[model samples]
Structure formats: structure tokens, C-alpha cells
Target: MQPDQVSIATQGLLKGRRVLVTGGARGLGLEFARHAGRAGAAVVIADILANELHAAAEDLRAEGIQAQSVVFDQSSPESITDCVVQAAQWLGGLDGLVNNAAITNSGGKALNELDIDVWDKVMAVNVRGTWLMSRACWPALKASGRGSIVNLASDTSLWGAQNLLAYVASKGAVIAMSRSMAREMGVDNITVNAVAPGLTLVEATEYVPKHRHELYEGQRAIQRQQVPDDVSGVVTFLLSDLSRFVTGQVMAVNGGFVMH
Candidate 1:
């Protein structure tokens, strides 16, 4: 099954693969699911938003793509566990995981004005949630014999954004954890990597100010706004045979906003 919007040559790029994407009902996650499906992977998108999740899945199905959506709560261990198990069952097995689910809160809140509850909530969803999802999918991933994991970080963490200390700190932890995750998962032929994307205009990012978009565009060498599609292809590559030998790397998809 494939989507009519975009076509891909399905010559084992992602053939016979099964992948699970968290926070995938819309925005970046939705794009990933669509692109991956086109590439020949059986894609499952999990998100906390039930109505949106079902709608996204139906859209894919309408395009002849076999897609599934599960209700996911990143901060809940039981939710993560059950979601992974069900996704694996639905797909027959697991081959890849995209930890794309994260909460950015309101972008501009300085530490002095930031609430403790907000900070803790950000950490719980971004940092701890990724770890929990990876752990829960470990066995099924190991069984794939060539499993891939993609954790979504952000450019804010890479080049430090003002008024987002908690989020930046959490993603920094994601970068730090990627190395260890790769080290451990390598033993099972599962590659672990993190992707840091610039501000992209998606449903989840509707709260971003217009000035911020202009600032990002002005700062980037590409001189354009980053879209959800810009970030999906790289992720599909990371989850394909192409990146079999690649791991422990953080690819910044910010159009040169944060170059390492």
C-alpha cells in the first residue's frame, strides 16, 4: 500500500519493514508515516490525540496505505508498553521506531518565569518518555535483527534557545543518551540516532510567532521556512538499509540554523 501524494521506488529501500512512530497523528510524525509508507514500510503512528490519530490513519488508508494509529501517552509507562506491544502485533514484527513525540510547551518562557511543574512535565515527556519507549520496544527491536531507532531532538537544544531552558536541557540529554543507546543497541544490530529539526510550521507549532519564523528563515542558509516534509526523508533514510552502518549520530535538519 502507498500514498498517491508522493511515490517512491519500493525496491527494498524499506520493503517488508515494520515501524512505529510516536506522536505521529499530525505534523512531523504524520509526514514520517506517509513517507515511510511510500517507501514500503508497514507504518503505525501512535499519538495521544484520539480524534486526530484516527483521522490520520483513515487518510492514509484512503491513499491505499496500510496505516494504524494507537492512542499513546508518552509519560505513562503502561501506555508506552501496551502501545508498543500492540503495534508489534499489528505489524507482525518491529523493525524501526521513531521517537518523534515531544512537548515544546509555549516556546518563550525564561527560567525565572518558568513554573517547576512545567519543567518537570517537559522532562517527563521529552527525556524520560523517549527512554521508556526505547526500552519497551527493545525486545521486538532486537528481534528484527536490524532495528533502527530515531529520537526527535530539536535545534533549540543544539544552539541554545532563550526562554526554553527546560526543553533545551531535555534534548541535550537526548543527544547525550543517543551515544549510550547506540552503544547498547549496537549489540543487537539496532542503530540509535537523534534528529534535531528547526522550527517547522506544523499543526503542533501553530503557536509559534510569525517573527520567530522570519528569524529562523533569515538565519538559515537556505533562506526558507522548514516544513514537515523537509524532515521526513532523512528519517526514512535513517530507518532504512541505507543507514545500517550509521548510529550514535545527531543529524540537524535546520537548513543550517545550527551547524556542527
Candidate 2:
């Protein structure tokens, strides 16, 4: 279904905003783009997946939303710089960013069993990539006068999920980095915050074991598997003026699974 074909009851919270989401061609990133578009923002979806990226953007355009897609490697500085510039050009301006691209399940092994190559690759993409994207978008964000950033973190970073040491560490770093970035960006009137979602059932997590799913579901006070929409709404709010005073915080959208 097209975007307009769906309910648009966001009250135009993000109207007149231009937002970009990394890894936005699939999974949770795509959901963020969907919500942003419905909230009345012109959105740009960037990802390394060429075909899916184009299709995702077309999906938005079919709904009469101003949307575009770009393919670039989050791990490559040159690619990130060029992509941000291209995204700003596509939207005619930039107001918000969703750093939702990151590597997880890098071997899915214990820290002692993890390969150095896998660890490095995860850090490069998950940690270093977020840094690069944020830096590249700094100028455009400042220009918006109502700049906002929502970094994707994980509940594992807060409550320690086993066998995913690298992902947990990377997200922990994201949480830390967001606090520092908020302190700095507040001078530019840009709010920087991280959304640490629990075990959300997105397309990327379709391979998750049934028992593992049950475990997460059972742990949640809501007693159900979390979905992308569960987190997307919070991200949309952060990107909108409704959350202007909220920054440097890690809002967990885990259905009370890992309350902090």
C-alpha cells in the first residue's frame, strides 16, 4: 500500500522537515523513513542495497511523498561524505538524520571466540560509520535551525545480551557518543539522542530462533514481540519539534523488557 493509503494521523509533527535515514532500504531503517514521510517530512533513504533502496524510495513516491534513495557504504568515509551531500541536494535541505545502519551478529560468538576481522568490520561499520555520517551532516543539520539526530542503539548495550559482545559494545559506544554529541550539538540547536530498542522483529531478524523470540517476548512486560513500528514512533517524535527539549538520552523502546 502507498503511504497516503495508510493512516497519516501523526498531526504533521515533522512537516517541512527534510530527513535522511541510513540503511533505510530495509528493516527498522525503512520503518523510520515510512513514519517520517507520513509525518510530513521529505525523506531520503540511503543504503548499500541498490535494488531494495530504489524500490523503497519508489514505494514512498508512489504515495506522493517526496522521497529518494542513495546507495553508499557506511564504512567508507568517501562514500558517506558523498552520500550526505547527495541526500541534502535531493531534499533541498536537511533537518534530521537517523543513523540506523549497523552491523550485528558478527559471528554471533562469545568475545573469546570472535574473530579479529569480524570485530574490526563490526566496529568500522557500526561505530565509525555513525561517527562519519554525523560529522558529514553537521553543516546541513546546523543550517536547519531545528536539527535532530536519532542514533540506533540496542538494549543489549544496556542489559548485556550474551554471545553478541561486539554488537553490544558498539551500541554502548553509540550511547556514549550520542551524549557527547548532544553536548556539542546543543550549541547549534540540534538535539542528539539514541533509541535503544530491544529484540524488535524486523525483516533483518526473521532468522531469529523461535525459542529466542519466545524468550524476549516473555521477558517483556507487554508479553509480545516488538515490531519496527514500536520503535519508529519514538524516532519520529525525536525528529519532530515535539521532542525539542529531549536530548542526550537513550530511550528504550523495548516494552519494559530492560527498564533502566
Best by lDDT: 2
Worst 10 residues of 2 by lDDT: 2-11
Per-residue lDDT of 1-260 in model 2, one digit per residue for the tens? 54442225574888899999999998999889988888889999999999999999998888777899999999899999999999999898899999999878563587789988888988999999999999999999999999999999999899988888888899999999999999999999999999999888888887667888899899889998798878888898899898999999999889999997
The top-ranked prediction according to TM-score is 2
Q: How far is candidate 1 from the true structure (C-alpha RMSD, Å)?
A: 1.9
TM-score for each predicted model, relative to the true structure: 0.96, 0.96
Scored by lDDT, model 1 comes in at 0.90
- Each model's backbone clash number: 0, 0
Q: Write the per-residue lDDT of candidate 1 for residues 103-191, one digit (tens) a residue.
A: 97736887899988888998999999999999999999999999999999988888988988998999999999988999999999999
Give the range of the ten consecutive residues with the poorest summed lDDT in model 1: 2-11
The lDDT of each candidate is 0.90, 0.90
